[model samples]
Target: MFREANSTLVDREWRIAEVCQRLEHDLEVLGVTAIEDRLQDGVPETIYTLRKAGINFWMLTGDKQNTAIQIALSCNFISPEPKGQLLLIDGKTEEEVGRSLERVLLTMRTTASEPKDVAFVIDGWALEIALKHYWKAFTELAILSRTAICCRVTPSQKAQLVQILKSCDYRTLAIGDGGNDVRMIQQADIGVGISGREGLQAARAADYSIGRFRFLRRLILVHGRYSYNRTAFLSQYSFYKSLLICFIQIFFSFISGVSGTSLFNSVSLMAYNVFYTSIPVLVSVLDKDLSEETVMQHPQILFYCQAGRLLNPSTFAGWFGRSLFHAVVVFVISIHAYAFEKSEMEEVGMVALSGCIWLQAFVVTLETNSFTILQHLAIWGNLIAFYVINWIVCAIPSSGMYTIMFRLCGQPSYWLTILLMVAAGMGPILAIKYFRYTYRPSKINTLQQAERLGGPISVSREYRATTTTDRERSCSIINHSTEEQKPSLRTSSFRFS
Candidate 1:
């Protein structure tokens, strides 16, 4: 009865946090209960795969240091082997924490020249001191360590850590499943929440919510990668098709005495962009460079996505160059095909437009990796619609395009000119693609080939063997790129699964 009364008094004093906290600790332990929350299925394998994909992980928890370390090991966040050393940074005061941080930094530097499997473990008390007094040194240490565990940390500290990583220009993904995690979830670039025993607060606050943690593997490697690839292709191709027409116009201006006479009728230009070219590229959103099973098995391919290999300056330049070349081919071929004949300017415009449509179609065909039935219908149906629409428009005797399609379709040279444009535009692209696939095949390229042949992709083991190297190289690239910025050193971006 006396103990119950004391507990009630303590609860009532909760408004005074310091007094309430002191009373909470002073209470006697009448009994102890233990509950085991085992790791979910596939958690370890998923973590392993993500790590191989060049992602760093940091575990922030309110659990005791020993308990957190145990959980980290059980979940494969850190290795069990001797080589995977655990460095601890803990102290009660500012001076002690600073000295410990310097010592850890020294050790990290000594091993920086070689590959080492090391993870740092820090408790909340020392973390608070280190972050407040030695933020730069602590940030450097965090950058060097691939995995870290911060135990006994409060919700505010979790958010602060996320902010620190972001301030360094690193992308952060925070995952949590409790009310205490709300701040951290809201603070990150990408927040994922698990809908489980911890309740719905985190899920409500996060950008994405999942039933289990293991689903993260698919979320990032499969959907995330597909989204990036499709966006890049869509954006770049939009530019390519637009530029293809504009380049032809610029070249035509030089020959047309620079009087700004439009090569294509305004209606034709509108239809080309809105109806003729839009659907095919839109369908490209469904494209995949490799199969889901293949990507899941060989996560090392994620290096390409992490390193910005697909959507970089070099790729944009290639697309720009391709567009310029195709425009030149279409314009030069159409003009030369009717050089001797007394063709109408509208006829020349129709011929050139035809070549652009066909060339763009084949260009999309060349880029598509996985084509669905819907994609098939969109591409071919759009092509057919181009002619049927033009034919209908040309039927209107009052329209500028009157008899244009009919006049061009009757001539065999018109068809030959289109064929030449397609052949010339596609020829170089195909050759370069073939050479790259045959001689310098990337992991994704190899998977694409195997998928095409309906053969077994047994390269998982081979890829696993090189995952360490790929991860190191990815980190090296990020670190080297950010080496110059000291006060606000941009660090490697991290994605948490």
Candidate 2:
């Protein structure tokens, strides 16, 4: 057979090599050979922990189906026969592939009520056919399955799978250690490359490159959670502070007969975001809602990030309502305190602005989970700077705010108005926060309480997710802050080629 095939491929060297390789594969083995390769330490535990943290993993490889299944079983990626069912999808013709896919889908539905695990195994040929003609059905199958293994696939096929997941609105993370995985890594929402024996091609092309695959656990559970938390607070607080000032301006417009009249001068508007409110939120980037140890222990806390509990429409609405409420308090209190007396618009503006500054100071203090000396300085020093800058600006004879701060400083009424605004603006919010922290605390709140009291967090079993399905379902909605989901983290050392 080899001689005949070689004879037919006389001038085509590539075709001759392909024909010879196919002919040689069916021959009986003269001897058995095995290579001893071991996984890195702590890999299985890391995967288990991350699975509990709500990340679903799919194995895509160039190895044969049996080899991939063996590796998956050894690594605890899927359970064996009794506990888990591996549905195979394959065929040469389009019709055969469709029939196989439908059968698997039917089996999945049949076992939908069972506690047994389900995973679908597909080879390159069937995947190609399914993706071309039955992508929607394939997508549903992938989503329903606890895990999936795509074996005997090409580099492009891996990327195509990633694209399909993304098209279904699921965020994907592709991690690879070699050149063949470069396309897949780049195609994912986030690309993580493992710098190992395979090569540097994937690492160089990836968004982040890590030295070891096991470090992925920390990358996701600890650092990934922190990044999400910090980014959510920073982005939302930015909008909150800006909206606070804007809402005040909109209220001022009503009293000014809808005419365009600036409440605070141009300088104050410019300085509010840059100097006054910027530091605390910037410092908040270093804030941790829970300790690293606690986060690692309670990986289920990641559900908040995946579900966007921190910065979703609900949280945004809360911030929006707070800004509007504070704006109203500032405007009404300032206007009423100076109603009968002869007061300049500049003085009223100063009164409202001072209230804003003080209220912001306390808001940051209230929301802070862990406070360091730096945070104290950023919050308090910023308040001091506001006063000092205003005092200096009022001293200048030509400035619009001239004598405004000085007059307000001398009056007990100015101080009273500010006190009144702060109380009215933040009193309800602080009360609600206290009530929730004391009575209706979440797991995060409990963890935060433990951190504050410097005690060990004793998480209840109920706090931990019971099933893998529940955990993955919580990870369905990527946080809504960015147009794209926050970049996920994954790491792989498999040589796809």
| Residue 415, candidate 1: C-alpha displacement in angstroms | 0.5
lDDT of candidate 1 over 1-497, digit per residue (tens): 33454557545444355555656886788999766545656768888888887777888777778877877787788899988878889899999999888988998888865667788888999999999899999888867777788888888988888887776655677877777778888888888876655568878998998876678889988998899899999999999999999999999999989999988888789899999999999999999998899889888777777666778889999899999999999999988887448788888888889899998899898899988999999898998999999999999989988888998889888887888888898999899999998999887887888888899886643343344333322221000000111223211111242
Residue 34 C-alpha lDDT in model 1:
68
List where candidate 1 sits over 4 angstroms from the true fold.
1-32, 460-497
List TM-scores for all candidates, in order: 0.87, 0.88
Stretch of 10 with least lDDT, candidate 2 = 476-485
- Which residue pairs overlap in candidate 1's backbone? none
Tens digit per residue, CA lDDT, model 2, 278-365 = 9888998778778888888888788877766787778988888888888888888877887446788887788888888999998888
Error of 2 at 316 (Å): 1.2
- Measured by lDDT, the strongest candidate is 1
CA error at residue 72 for candidate 1, angstroms:
0.6
TM-score of 2: 0.88
